[model samples]
Target: MNKLEIHSPNSPILLTASLHVDEARKAIASLVSDLLTESQSRNEAGSVELVTLDQAINRILAEDLLSPIDVPAADNSAMDGFAFNGDCLSSKDDIVTLKVVGTAYAGKPYEGSIGKTECIKIMTGALMPNNCDTVIPQEFTESSDSSSVTFKQNQVKRGENQRLRGEDLQSGKAAISAGRLLRPSDLGLAASLGIATLKVHRKLKVAILSSGDELRPLGQALDAGGIYDSNRHSLTGLLNRLNLEIIDCGIVRDDPASLKSAFLEAASLADVLISSGGVSVGEADFTKQIMQELGDVGFWKIAMRPGRPMAFGVLKPADPKNPDRKSLFFGLPGNPVAVMVTFYQFVRSALLQLNGANQTEPPLIQAIAQTPIRKKPGRTEFQRAILERGPDGRPTVRLTGSQGAGILRSMSEANCFVILHHDQGNIAAGDWVDVALFDGLL
Candidate 1:
């Protein structure tokens, strides 16, 4: 039998007194660890598909990248200079004259060896001929004849402008590790290693659903107590960047039977299911009941601002006829900002794990405040703000006027998020705070 990994804290499911932010994060982290491990192991038949360098962007590596050959392949000139023995250079007044033996251009190398006191005109990236030890810039060398050149008075030493073979990477060394999410720079690095193709993890298949009786499809006339569904389109945009295969399940009503049928249909086709709205304990909410009926629900009310209620669980078949399969399910709250934050904070890690990508640390910076802000201690808050360089050359953060949970416009215009910890609440002007840069978004 498979091990049961659902978490059950001794305290109530919902905290009465606000929890310390660190404690809350720790709890969530523990749950995420288990979730990720299970996800990784279940995907053990993990295979990598070979893709061309052009097609490898945003794909996760499925195997360790071993360098097949040494970089540079041989010592080369780093600048357009004269390649000669570096030990021949002495004091500034000691002008050393050497016979110019040949010229070396990029992609074409001289095959002959160099004699003592002989130099060669070499261009940048040109392979240094045999017996060459240093490169002196052409400007540093004064040529009396086309056949010979003399070093001018300068404080230069041996091997000053030579790029040694394998300086960047050695043969058989690890070029990139397994589970690395490919970035633009990573692609360049792999290309430098002569890797025209890479083995990458398969993209995740996800099913998306939106729930609410008051929600109507866009371009349709809205009935009383109804609103247009925006979560579906917003989530699709996010998933597009993640390289996920999305199956839009459309909108499910608040009725139990309809939700159950939608869940069944989605679970049959997707490895993961994401539901927005209808997870809270409101009277009209049917997602939570349907989720529990189909599988186990480990609901968490993380002590964090903007996003308080989030649900995670596995979705299985409710009827006995169809059984023995389950897919991961995440129920995000209905508020736009809440959904975005919770997905970034809680679900991003899980999704990366499922994709076989390793977790990377978020970028943080210290920015001085431009104005005073009021915040209570208890939960962590990510306030959107604009960052600008002050006269002192230090970055300063100015909060967007409103800190409301539904303010998506503020998030769009912000470049950074000021992280307000649970312990300290009151902040004064000019106080320094930790800012999480929105590098991923921008």
Candidate 2:
């Protein structure tokens, strides 16, 4: 058999690929580009809902929100003081005592206009009466009587302590662009612009699944050869944080027939399908077989140590049940640590592309290793480590323990992953290492 070939039938190797790490990634990215291109054609059928500003939190902007009117609406006072003609204040020491023509409060305009040597008492957010050019803060003026005040100093400049109309947003200008995800501050900005309703992109629908005969549900009796399904729960929580619509497909057997049914159902309803386990080289690894039957399995096997057999593909119906509808899928490995590493490296990128995210890669930083480490030279490695600030304030990191695929406790104890490049064989203490911060689980 060739290096890429995986012997079928009763062969020991379940699935193998000829491509190396970089080649595999490029191939997978190519497939993902196709899927993303096709996804663009799948028009969102969900109808829009006119929700109030309070209810529109975290939704995508469906259309560009333009300002119908300028923010501040008109020239207004920024503080509680007096509005006056700025030219009347001649010098720094010049103090002009003027009668208060009218009092103004926020949302209530002062009827009378200010003339030369005249002023109007105004409150915060209150509009300046016509012909007033500047506002003197109340702290700089002394109240001589209820209807008059004396300026203590005359150093204020024109438009000082005043909010000019359209300073923030001009009429017909775009206040918020289309496809922006709404946040608290965004909501407040929209509210300030008098926008009660906003059009936003529909929430992405994702289907999550976990497969293994040894898996058991929560609060269920664990018989022999059974383990609780932690991958499904972990993925569900992660997707929840992204604010996507999650369709839990629950647990399924490691059989080809069962996987086929689950894939069909997930493909029909969900925008993306994520499955854990049954993609390795085992005889019972039905996910690999089922993937070939259902659609095109683009790439499998990344030359990353912990996550080697990562799979990416688009599901197409073999039968006539919506043959044109292609559903994106990511087949993560069975080991918990492998699941996480592959998800972050591969699945996350795919999801971002599906969601129209602009940036696909996470941030990276460089740090020094605390101890010497040894490894084989074929694949890259992600060693779990705890990063710390040294006495000199420099960042340093130390690996927890054994860097095994099954050692999930090591990942839990470490705060970051010290990345070892593919060609690297070993490292000495105090050597520089590339560290990827564990921003969150996966």
Q: Residue-pair clashes per candidate, as listed?
A: 0, 4
Cα lDDT for residue 424, model 1? Answer: 71
Residue 224 error, candidate 2, Å: 3.0
In angstroms, the error of model 2 at 142 is: 9.5
Model 2 misses residue 371 by how many Å? Answer: 9.6
Candidate-wise lDDT, in order:
0.76, 0.75
Steric clash pairs (candidate 1): none
Residue-level lDDT tens digits of model 1 in 1-442? 1212223323323322334445544554554565566656666564558999898888899888999998878999998878887657653557788888888999998777788678888899999986887888877766646698886646457778999999988899888999997889999999887789999988888999998888899989988998888888878877776777899999998788888999888987787899888655563134555665677655556668777776666777644553555677788888777777777666666677767778543568899999997888767887889998999999999998787877788777888788887767888999999998766632
Alpha carbon lDDT of residue 85, candidate 2? 82
State every prediction's TM-score relative to the real structure.
0.88, 0.74
In model 2, residue pairs whose N, Cα or C atoms come closer than 3 Å (at least 3 residues apart or on different chains), thus clashing, are 14-281, 60-200, 62-199, 62-200
Off by over 4 Å in 2: 1-33, 39-44, 47-55, 89-103, 136-155, 281-286, 303-306, 318-321, 356-442
**Poorest stretch of ten by lDDT in candidate 1:** 1-10
